[model samples]
Target: MAAILTSLRNTVIAGFVLSLVLILMFLNWGGTLDYNFCAFLVRWLHVISGVMWIGLLWYFNFVQIPNMPSIPDDQKPAVSKVIAPAALFWFRWGAMSTIVFGIILAWQNGYLLDAYTLGAAEGFSVHKNIAIGIGMWLGTIMWFNVWFVIWPNQKIALGIVDAPADAKPKAGRTAMLFSRVNTMLSVPMLFAMVSAQNIY
Candidate 1:
């Protein structure tokens, strides 16, 4: 019992199982779960994952990369070997999850195409549609970079999985440059998303 509780994976799995049981109990007790509840859940998932993704992006740009030059050569591997790989794991998955949940939320509300097309009716308002469209586009680009460019490069750079030794430096620089590009776009992407709720 104590051993199970002490394991990080076991603890997380137990918590999830407990939460699932509670949700099932609520459903059995005639607590109606509606479309709104599902939408809320999807939105919550989006927000949580977005925070994790962007938080690590900031950490990389604002904290780790900026401080790298100052660290001694002997200490640098600790950051590259240990901290980076862990952070990258969360960062890439968070980006993927955020996009997935955002799509699910939009699809559930029957606005996935409408939002993508910037509101596709004569009576529709353009403000919210445009805002959400920009966010969606930006998120899509960021997701592409995460999976295709950044993650592949980072795997090489950190030696998580290897490539030619000569590839490491180039891969690392490419990942950092793309990350910086994403960081610059994130500000407007967030603005567009938040503004979509009210600006219309």
Candidate 2:
């Protein structure tokens, strides 16, 4: 138990194992369970990934980035050399996983085309599709920012890339700005997605 709790891989495996246990305990396989169950599972995974992604985003904004100036230069390497890079790995993957699961969930729920097309698909409620579409588009943009704008710049800022000395500061600023852009989008994106429950 302690080993599983302490090891991330083990912990994640345990979580999935528990989820399976719960599903088996409650759901009537092949009789009561159907596509809805799969949709729920994917939605659950999507929410988990989104939480990891946004939690780290907020941590960077509300904690790490803001507190960086106060950390002494000597202690900075702990954050820069070790912490930030590790966080970024999960951050980028979280974004990818969230988007992938989100799309799968939408498809499972039978509104993928409607949402993607901004309510143009027949039989889907325009309002609901618009709401979910807004969220999806916002999330997509955030994912793009994470992979392209932020990660590339962060590589330079963290000295992972061979960048000119004068380029580091600019790269850091670009990453921060794009991160802020995602942060700003998060609120509306969340509202759109959540509010869709009632709308649909």
Candidate 3:
């Protein structure tokens, strides 16, 4: 038990197994599995992943980065080596998962392109279309940074790949700056996403 709990991989596997069991139980207890059900599952995945991504974004902005300079050099390694990497593992993957599920949801509903374009008149009511379009654009930009800019630099910063000593700090700063930019965009992104559903 102690050994199992100590290994992060084993712990995650165990947790997933337990959750699968519970979900199976729910299905047995009259949860109708259908397209809508599948869509609901995907949406749930999107929500969960979005929370993790944004949560880490806030953690970086609100807590970790601000405190970094004050942390003793020896102690900083624990954060950079263990904590930040772990958080980022979830962060990048969460961003990917959110985008995947969101796309799936839109596609399944037969509005993928329309929503992307803000539901241009022929396809949807004007207001709702525009609102969804704004959210899609924000999500796209966030996704772009997550994959193109942030991940590459983080690889260097975390020393996941070999990098010149001087290059590492530069990479780290670049990643951090883009992450802050994402944080700023997230405010409006979330607002437009939620407001679209009801307001328009």
Candidate 4:
């Protein structure tokens, strides 16, 4: 247990092993591997990826960005050159995984078009569809910002890509502002997602 706990990869593997054990203990394998079960698994994966994505996003907004100014200039390179890049790698990939799995979940549940269209296929009559549609759209927009806007600008701001020195400050500010925009949208997006679950 100690050895597993000391290594992140082992710890994650152990967690999945435990989950599998619990599933096997509680469910009969013969009846459980059906469409609904697969759908539930996809939903679970979607949720886990989303937690990774949003957790890092909040960490940046609520912790790192707000506290950066207090750090001395000499030590700032530790964050800029090392920690920020590592965190951004996970952040961007988490966003990608989240969006991919979310779309798969939506498709598996047979609401891809309805939710995307915000229930327009059914004449806007389904409240749940509308709710999830809003969440999906917001999440998609956030994903887009993370990839196309934030990541490119971050590469410049972090000096992973060469840019004119004057351009760095502008790139950093753009990334920060867009991150803030995503943070603002996150609350409502989460609300819509949760509301969809209970709207029926």
Q: What is the TM-score of each candidate against the true structure?
A: 0.83, 0.92, 0.83, 0.96
Q: Write the per-residue lDDT of candidate 2 for residues 117-139, one digit (tens) a residue.
A: 88976544578888998899999
Q: In candidate 3, which residue ranges exceed 4 Å CA deviation? A: 1-31, 121-125
- Candidate 1 weakest lDDT stretch, 10 residues: 118-127
lDDT of 2: 0.92
Q: What is the C-alpha RMSD of each candidate to the true structure, in Å?
A: 3.2, 2.1, 3.0, 1.3
Q: Indicate which candidate wins on TM-score.
A: 4
**All candidates in order of lDDT, best leading:** 4, 2, 1, 3
lDDT of 4: 0.94
* Candidate 3 similarity to native, TM-score: 0.83
Q: Candidate 3 residues 86-176, lDDT tens each?
A: 9888889989988988898878877678878787756556766577778878988998998999989999998989999899999999999
lDDT of 3 at 51: 92
Measured with C-alpha atoms, the lDDT of residue 136 in candidate 3 is: 75
Question: How many angstroms is residue 38 displaced in model 1 relative to the true structure, after the best TM-score fit?
Answer: 1.3
lDDT of 4 by residue, 1-200 (tens): 89999999999999999989877975864556778988888888989999999999999999999999999999999999999999999999999999999999999888989999999989999999999999999999999999999999999999999999999999999999999999999999999999999765
| Per-model CA lDDT versus the true structure | 0.88, 0.92, 0.87, 0.94
